[model samples]
Target: MAAQLPIPIYSSLEDAFGGLRTASGQSVRWANLAQEFKSRFGREPAYIARAPGRVNLIGDHIDYVLFGVLPAAVEHDILIACGPSMSPVSSNSGSVAAHNLDPRYVPQTFAPMLKSAPLPTASEERDAENTVHAESWHMDIDTKELRWESYVKAGYYGVLNHFFPAAAGSTTTGPHPVPVDLLVTGCVPAGSGLSSSAAMVVASTLAFLAVNNKVVGLTKGELVEMAMENEKRVGVNSGGMDQAASVICTPDTALYITFFPSLSAQPTPLPTSRTVPRAVFVCANSLVVSDKVVGAKTRYNLRVVETLVGARVLAHHIGVVLAPTERPTLREVLGRWLGFYEAKNVPSDLDTDMLREGVQKILPYVEKLRPTRDDGELGVTMEEMIEWSGMPEAEFRQVYLSWVDVEATHFQLYKRTKHVFEEALRVLRFRDVCFSSEAAILPRDTLIDLGALMNESHQSSIELCENSCPEVDELVRLAREAGAFGSRVTGAGWGGCTVSLVAEDMVDEFIRSMKSTYPPYKYLGDDELREVIFATKPSSGAFVLKL
Candidate 1:
């Protein structure tokens, strides 16, 4: 049971990082950002918002389908320095002037267009007692091409609609947002699958919330929900894993986040055997950019539709009755197979043993989804899928394909379901090993056990989910040959980064081996290579710095 705590705010760097030792270096970096903000915008910042990127250790594509995932906050993060603007143009209209530390992203200035309609009068409201009146706010976001300020606008859109309603004639009583100037700086590499997009959204969201005086009583869970909804505005239907890990994770532990019953998280300590050498998770970027927005229609979004449709077909095969409008996830389908529905009889606390048993019990039944056609094809066409779904073409398209944009001629229901179930079991097994290890008496093969699970997960991503690419595959191969206990693609696998388990003493040696053996690092200089690959540990999550 995770505690529901409001987002943290600190007056000093020392308090923000929880110690003077940790804050010493950060103080200089943050000070430099503030100084740069002054240089760019000609004013001292009032507040700074920080949010971290995350690396998923296991459970990749299953998160959108509502399964437990293990991910920890990386030390690399995004920071935003913002204050109210005083320009006459900005003062009259709630305009935002945004700049980034990186030159590739040019400066952008935009404002939300408020509606022209006035609010209903008190008597009119009383006359229409059962009716509700609402006005929508509009912000222009280009979903086709990736824009840096689009994320900023997405975050601000949520704040505008939720807090400030646009009504003409000054009839609305709610508060209006102030025009803001923000300077953005970050070390989280973009397109590396470390979730720089989520970090940006979280940091930007927090910046608006803090500047608007809406930070009071905003729980971590609420922030996660807001950020999740905010991120979808930028054109990727991602799971809550990235946003939740960025907001809710604590120091020195990986979060075990479950999504079915309700959004809850547990800070599970990643322990090592006392007898064996200590191990750390190393992130090595493949240098292959995974643009989720550009690739969503064919890769990410297609997988989502396939898995979802697979769940409905599986339920039909299992003699389970599903409403025509219901879109059940693989996890919910498994629950139904186990005789549980809508979270009834679901344990609040995560029981690895029970989850393990449930996966085992359902593994055989999943075979029912195998293609029974004699044509020797491994997948089903759209017509065949609709027929198997036991729904008319109109209803099937409405239920599954209307809300999301996905392009697929063939759907691999069997392969996708098989991978999801097996990968879920692997997650439970991995969690069990982490819990089994103790400081006093540790298993000699602790790292080996954990590494093996990671290896299995990558294989599933490659064969079943089909998200891994040649660059990622070769990178994983080199990592294992270079002495990683277990190495796999960390984030969305089309072209991102890989997380490897390596002994503490051998981290330098492991990096050296990768640099020499991997062709991508051959021409790079020391700093460039360092940025592409490095060692990392679980770090603290998002926070606000009051200047």
Candidate 2:
């Protein structure tokens, strides 16, 4: 593993965009945002924070299982123009007036309702189990109804609770954050798989950090960790892939992000063949809005519990020992089963071969999770699942169901497990192809193989993970029919967007084909169609700009 460095802060547009060539376009966007900021708030802005949304090129739901995922940061991003509020300084906390260029999201002006809870004594918090707990700073975030500014608040909450602690027993009180006025704008389509939420959270986090002068030495990985925790405040039990891709990605390469042994990322260059034109990814929105928070209990979060519980049951059958209270992910279960857990650095430490083969070897064991019923039931009941885990119902509920809320009468343990293992293997293979220099001669062949993996991934998502919707499935089918190399649903998947691997030369034609055929695109005019779908390249990650 390599040591990750701090995110760079740039002073000029040329440096921010990485070169003068790309700076022209970005300069216009930033200038427009600044102009909007000046009109919205009555002064020149002090700093701008930017975080790009990501398109998961290969991996999907396996990320929550601690598996590595291949995702690239797209050009579409969230930008926050912020400066100190004119309000009088307060010793306790800061206030914010947040406005969005998109009118649908109304402006919000609010402040953190700070409260100091009594800190527990050392012995009072200690237990024989070493389960230590501490009182944390409080901020209310309504996770039920979806709100745009909640993301802004979520970012602020982490900075406040982590950097400015004020427990009752504290000797030194933390300094108050400066009041801020922010104007937000983004091109990343929200509710689509492109990870607009993560972009928003990451940018908001950077904005808060910059305004407070705390971004001086923060590593990109550290920012990713904070954004991951921050997003949970909005009620989604998501994995770290989105935040990692948003914070750690580099231009022209996809990131292979792993959370297992540790959070680490490696940028894998996208392959290109001398025999064929370059390939690009086209993002086509399903326009169905996959709201992770709104559908979490029954959809996204439900799958998470199913996968975790499935791992527990599978581990029990595979003779892997787990603590009675332990809730291991499928990746951890695979490590234990392959005896890689005992290795000095583990399977993922070396190369993808060991991990790929391990997934193939353990895949047959996933059948152990199949329900032992005669009526042809594919899923197991809650009671049956508990029995399979060898844990009491209360304990099972406490370990897996206590923290997150999920609702499902019958859990598809077998399907979820199968999808995870298969998808994990695909991600490893995808990374291998991208890293293979031999691909130079057969770049077209490489694209085909990659596309096949994406196609297979979408099928698994449909049959096993059950995350795709009709609009997404239709878009994928249309993409394939329109000559895309491969296509699949890209995000949390109940509905959002489908990313397709298309030849660079055929992109315009492909978009034309989609518009002529796909129902959603039929009514959209040129501008509306552009907003809903477009070709994208791997772009730079999150950064802060100082004036």
Candidate 3:
């Protein structure tokens, strides 16, 4: 098995800071919040919190299923500078001074804060939820004005509800018990299938805990749980992997993690020599949103797993022990027997012995359902099943047979992915720099190897997974033609983004070609067409800057 990414940590702060310099082009100056606190409250600031956005290079849409995903923190991060608030300082005072005031910062009072500011235009408000805005930040206060910052505030409230419910009782009243005044900022691209929202939630939890002086006492497991609960406040049902990855990932290692109610992370290194190669990943937006497809597929996958689990429970009643993976085969067998029993072409109802034989005939087909090579090929092309279904009978048969062949191919491809990742780990282990290797090496080679896998993955996603759309397919082709090493659609397919690996030397050429070939259809000059091609590398998870 491939090694997983690590859970992020506070100790990685220095390296995380280094990564941020590259991302934001501004060196992080840990806010001298302690000094600011003294000036504001006549006391030292109590705590700090940091959170990072995540990029899924491969294995998109698999994390929520408890399946493995290859994601890492990007250099972009959200840092909260917080301290106890005091009355606003007098403008005439040349020196700053702090005085203790009520800690209760009522959320409802936020409405009045909005009234003090101008309202955003109707169009700006509609896109504000997912897209970033500059002018709108100064607009009227409504739930929407909260934008990215709201996630943090909501998460803080969530933490409060979880840890101090009595204090958060509905009857409680005050300046609305302000937990913290968070100054949030980040560089992670929004709506690109990167876990920007998850980072915000995780970082918010960390900030809340830090302000309360609770981080030092909490165990790693406790931290992950706290972040998970915080995300629940946003109404997004997610397994804790994204938060865990942000919290625990080291510099050069990819943390392979497994989560139940808690988390376990095993850091794996990349394959490389002393001179680690510089690599880049090209993220090409297909201009398609993934909400509906990703959501539906997630639910469907969950339902299938649940049904299989229920089948296993019933099988145990008949004195048979079966694993969940085996339930689908068993169900198929039962279906075949039922089909035989109801066959009008047959003279009579089949006996158990005959039904058993019918099941035997179907077993071969059931077993072949395992993922295949063609699945990987199809994934690359971004094709849909409906498209294939429209083919003529002879062509369909040929495609169907090729599809059958994909099962074995996909099994081999999965094995190949595991082998490459493991070998990369071995290389890092031999270097005796496992920790740094994770921070540096793994991210580079993983992108390269992952790029290769992406080609195959996209092929399979299109052919077998049956989630490809024409626009997505065209984007993949455009990326490859633009000189990407390999390209594939990321996320739940049918449209989202296509992740590509571009050689260092070809980066400029690739960008130029993509821009010329795929010009914006909706926007003209001066409109500042949103960048469709983004270059990224592995980065650290969230953290707080005490500026």
Candidate 4:
């Protein structure tokens, strides 16, 4: 006898659209029934999933470094309708809705899943017994989701797999097949650095779990970890904040989250109670897409910090072994071991002696090699130094002392980076103060401060953090001249969107000015650029509603 299948309750299209429109402010006019969504399986839909988009307000290029970031869920979302197929008409049409599902929508498998009975929901007892099996299933789903959708899909699959592997996993040679039809649609802008991608993944995961009647067994921390792992499966290499924000944030409040091995969040109220003098942010496109540079920068930053810290820890261990008479301060020992050459002033003749001498004093705490000094006079550029440290990983691995000594350079780099970061943080705090005070009531002044910070952040990112690109610089310039209060590159830098804080009164004016001045050159022409600028805002994140 066939196992009793969970009865799928399909929401009316009208209800789905109504709930979606209310939540996202996006219209979901169902396409022609016959053309938009045709079932490839002879069964009805059992469930639906909706995911939202997100925007990062601060902490760009810091996620891969395992640093904390502030992100908010936006009003934009991706809505997916999944259920049993009612007909085997090969719903493989070239429609907009079909295109959305193309990435993960496997027509053949979906058709079968719809035909078979839905898997039974796991009880608490069943969950405990199948925890290991469930985890394996989650990993498989994570892998499958990564193939076509954004990293978010990978996260969703991971959670589902961990909680309900039997149903989520694919199978062969079974009379009852696993067929799940997914129809996806969304309004989140792609590649906007708003983390729209992550939001969608998180929302979808929740929706999928809801439909399957599976419960997350882990603590809040474990749940976030699972979500982050799912995202990693998609190869985007992001932190867990986006998923956290999507699931945990509330309207009108910014969430402050700290993520290490686990996730913890608190809502920090906006400084002011009044809505006037609203916080405005603008976005500009850098017109370049170099994921490799962005990814490299992220990895490089992480490696530098780890290497430096690791070297220091190791040096402390070595200190314990040395005899009192022969022992030296960790700093002195490191300086001697790494070949210290000078202090305070790096000499003009930057030979091996100088390089060794310069690194000597701090060698105990250092972890990587400093980039060769640029000229005999000016030291090596920070970017050059970071790139150099990563150059000979294999050779450095062969020699223990050489490797640790070379690794010490990263310690110095991190210290320098931290100083710059501190300044930026100070500026942000000041802005918050200004916004909370009289400036909150004055719209124009608020914009001026916001813009100033935007420019300040860009300068710091370029000179201190070393993450700016020419396109970003150009965008900032264009935005400022066009009456934008402030504009800077968003995301991991090298290339991405630039966000500006503008006045509500001047938004239209600023948009018009930008359109006239920059004229929107590449992929999107002037008209498209105009449209994008007009549409962006500080929006809400993901949510679920009965339709």
Candidate 5:
């Protein structure tokens, strides 16, 4: 059963986060990938792995620091058809080859690195030289750099080391390591806000696991953790949001995933025909792909580093004695500070009012920010953040800003912290509207409230986070003007795609009007625009198919 099946099942999506929710099914046939796999590899694919792309309805950029994020798995996904090679066993075991049907991605044929033993688990720490584990197979040169193939290799290695160790052959009962022929086909656009990279990595991981007979018993949560750790080989400090959303999402419902206490995904019920007069979600690409891999130093990773540094500075301001190398997030710092204010007998669960009140208490500690020479637009500098900090520069540097180098001395401590906490609350509010008892009686009002939350999220991302670029702003503006209920940048901003709320009846007009007015959509033909800009429902989690 383990060899024949895909992943563990969930009875409901809520049980998934609390445990997960399930949905009405929607699936496409694997006729093309199946045919392509056979055509290229000379045999049928033993199994296929599919992972969907997600559209964030409200929450943005809060997942990394470990807060709640609400994202819906859209219909588009990455699919990989794979099977173990039937050829005679090689003297060396760690051989795997991958082919992308799109042709944009170059195929890689890898030979075993001739390891002394099996690969190490991703959870294990690397030595000072950052060498691969003693048992591992390959070494990715330069831990900071990212390559297209590295993502795939990370997935392959994750499953291989976890399930098939060096000693696996001598004593293990499961399938042994074999050369895998992988054929990838993706509907999700790369560098779009929809998370194409995570989907690809997940699809690859599942495929590798299945071919090696490692799929059946693995829980969704377990797979999610593996995917998140595997992608870290690419070097960005991304959170579990993308990986978890792709794996645990249910169609017609958005997953409200929380990483703090533990990994859990609560599938919030989306409006249905029965609950509402009409409801639809549309995703429009700015046509500017914000590839996190490229320019990570200046763009994404810088923000990540800034947040951690900001967290450390705030902890210092509050007199919280944290060890060096401790990177507490804004959420953690806020909770600690809230405890400080509560003094004796702090409430275990603080409501929004109480949290906002906590912010009020901490407000006096926050100084009017001083700008740095470069990147002052992000708001405050490291120097200004610790102007009130008595901690020495060397110690601060050792503790917080050591992970990634930044050209900007100034960081947006206030904005970054403010956005994460407020947006985390906004996500909760959006979920509230989705599940409110009044949703059935007052669908239009509920929808309007939800739209307003999305609008606020966009403004915050633009004004507070400063991650939204001109292209993204323009597209969001165009969508709203074209009659979207609300629109916001869906992925890690700077440029990518925007998700919009719309009425089901108004979907046709909304798409048409935006296409005519928007430059990117104006240039594309109707058929092209249809694929590029369309409404979608929440989709299912990653699963394997016996092809």
Candidate 6:
């Protein structure tokens, strides 16, 4: 019942992928895909979902705790060609067959398993209302290891549970949504910071929703949440930033996505000079992949724990009790403090500026309280955190550590929290520069200034967040030397891709120079290098296309 297909349907043979102002050759591309789907599925496809990969323009590592992030959807994307299965192939069940055009990923076909597939526990389903109904059959995908198809299964299960809750038994009477067949192909580089996994998940969810006609009434925010929860099944504790960007973004613009009170998005216009009118973002791969999934224990999820623990310790030290619902985002803590200061200090005639400044000054950066025992292991002990909090061990563990096991002792509390706040501020400033009136007077300088912020962001990620690796920093240096105005690692750092604010006119030379100068590129063949190291325009958000 979606007002329109998530993707455009091509009624005219002429329009295939043409209606959405799809990339230059994308129209032809979709037309060909439709024919290919027909050949593979033995029927014409019912729908196609397009979810573009994203590059974090400024903000990084701050989104999951509900922070504002600026990101743009790139041209590279995961395209899901979907059609109903022609046969159930069994008396009791149906199946979803998937193909990877790239062949790098093993093809996957999934079905509803009544007992063998592990469904979510009632508590894990997000809410009481979302509990698995006796009639609801939410087939669980085994994400035990590095299975390529885990992403596909995650998306399928994500939408399945959301729209067509499987009634526990196959005998239960309900609307029988045909099992779907999906053929996925994409230009997005996998394992790079471009968010290819998110694109795949979003694209698959759209396909399932579209196939069931469940898309009509659902809002974008609802879909965003569903996709995020789906990803958590794969063990990565993601914030909605990537999924939000894929869902809410528009073509040729960056989205300033804020997630404080509610998920809201505003398009921030990029200033491009007449000659260089379109913002040119060059994504240079560091060739390092930070697997947020299994590595969740040591990297991304570990940082989430650190921030939570830090917030608890900070709150206890300052005598501010945390409300059960409040997460330990520094921004939220400061807001609460501001409210308290106003209530108490106004009567004392305290200078408002001094009171506000005093609040920041009073907040301490206690490294001893950090959960990380070693930055290398990215683990922290309960005893260390409890000692720092000056609170009961049980209270600290229940409030902050929760169910996670902190196995390492070294932590970088000062650095990680410092990066989140500073980077959050930088994202705002970077967005302001794009909108500032003076941007016209010094457009080039303005872009350069933006790059400087990126440089600072990378430096902080390395020095403080400890997310950057040797290759990540080296890539930034090389991109800078290659005439990038500014560049920094995009995604979860460690290894992935770098986003360089490149001058439009200089992009060709910039990419070429980077290839020649970087040692990694020395090994990639010309065609491979061309594809991986290229300039990108801010592309459209996730959508559907029909043939």
Which candidate number has the best lDDT?
Answer: 2
Q: Which stretches of candidate 4 lie over 4 Å from their true place?
A: 1-47, 64-66, 84-135, 138-147, 150-153, 165-178, 215-223, 260-262, 269-279, 290-416, 423-447, 519-527
Ranking, lDDT, top scorer first: 2, 1, 5, 6, 3, 4
> In model 6, which regions exceed 4 Å deviation?
1-24, 88-94, 114-140, 166-170, 273-279, 323-327, 340-381, 390-407, 438-442
Off by over 4 Å in 2: 1-3, 89-92, 117-135, 166-173, 272-275, 342-350, 438-441
User: Local error of candidate 1 at 487, Å?
Assistant: 0.5
TM-score of each: 0.93, 0.93, 0.57, 0.63, 0.85, 0.85
Q: After superposition, how far is residue 345 of candidate 6 from its true place, in Å?
A: 30
Give the lDDT of residue 510 in candidate 6.
86
Residues 332-386, model 1: lDDT tens digits: 8777777766645665433567677888888887788788878876688999999
Task: Give all candidates' CA lDDT scores.
Answer: 0.85, 0.85, 0.47, 0.47, 0.73, 0.70
- Misplaced by over 4 Å in model 5 are 1-29, 88-91, 112-135, 141-147, 165-176, 272-276, 340-390, 438-441
Candidate 4 clashes: the total is 32
> Per-residue lDDT for 125-171 in model 5, tens only?
35534343324446543345555666677787688778666544353
**Candidate 4 structure quality by residue, lDDT tens digits, 1-547:** 0001121223454343345545243334333211244543333334445555555556554444333455555556666655433334444210111225444444322121211334435542233321112343322222212233444345445544565344433343322212234556665555555555565666556555544444233243454455666655554445566666666655555555544223456554543233355545666655565442134424333433443433333344334233322322222334444444335344222332333343443433333323345443222333444344343444324322232112222334443334233432533443354446543345445456546665776776676566677867887888888766567766656765777766556777777676666644444676777535643443343433323
lDDT digits (tens) for residues 291-353 of candidate 2: 788879999899999999999888888899999898889888888787766355553443578
Instruction: Provide the clash count, candidate 3.
Output: 67
